[model samples]
Target: MKKFLEVAEKLAHEKPLGPKYRNRRLVGNFKGRWECHIEPGWLLVYLKTDQEIIFERTGTHSDVFK
Candidate 1:
């Protein structure tokens, strides 16, 4: 999960404005939250605020959705 953290850190700074995070998008039914693929089946979910990025969840697709 180290790589996931590194990518999440980079995303916290760059957000949707950067090409590296092109796949990031807002999640349905979860206001202020966004989702991004970390690997084939792993995902990293977070909520962005004016001051900081708050991590909400991370896991395989099925595990995270649960």
Candidate 2:
């Protein structure tokens, strides 16, 4: 599959800061949008410029990650 550069850059540019355990690694893309994977199997989805909602992916956690 093709990697979405826009989504990748957006996810990289906007990151939630913290003292420890940066959650920024949660970044991913879905349905033409850039999303973040927070919990073990939950996707924290939203538009690039706003907050988001938790969701589920159809594939295994590892498969959907990349």
Candidate 3:
């Protein structure tokens, strides 16, 4: 949790980190949103706008996707 927050903070301040963070744009109904892996099944979903980064969800794969 601590490490995830640290990385999330960095992502919010800087440009997308890269593959290490598993940052990728979501498709389908989730189009326009982006996601980053925190662990094996844990993920953080969010949207990046011109003014701010909006976090939409954070949880395990099942929980987040559902």
Question: Evaluated with lDDT, which candidate comes out highest?
Answer: 3
lDDT (C-alpha, whole model) for all candidates? 0.71, 0.41, 0.84
Give the candidate order by descending lDDT. Answer: 3, 1, 2
TM-score of predicted model 3? 0.85
Report residue 37 deviation for candidate 3 (angstroms): 0.3
Once superposed on the true structure, which residue ranges of model 3 sit more than 4 Å away at CA? none
7-49, model 3: which lDDT tens digit per residue?
6788778755667678899999899998998776788999989
**Model 1 — TM-score against the truth?**
0.72
Candidate 1 collision pairs: none
Q: What ranking of all candidate models by TM-score puts the best one first?
A: 3, 1, 2
Residues 1-66 of candidate 1: C-alpha lDDT, one tens digit per residue: 787877777766774434544455665676568877777677777887778888888888788787
User: Candidate 3, which ten residues in sequence have the lowest lDDT sum?
Assistant: 12-21
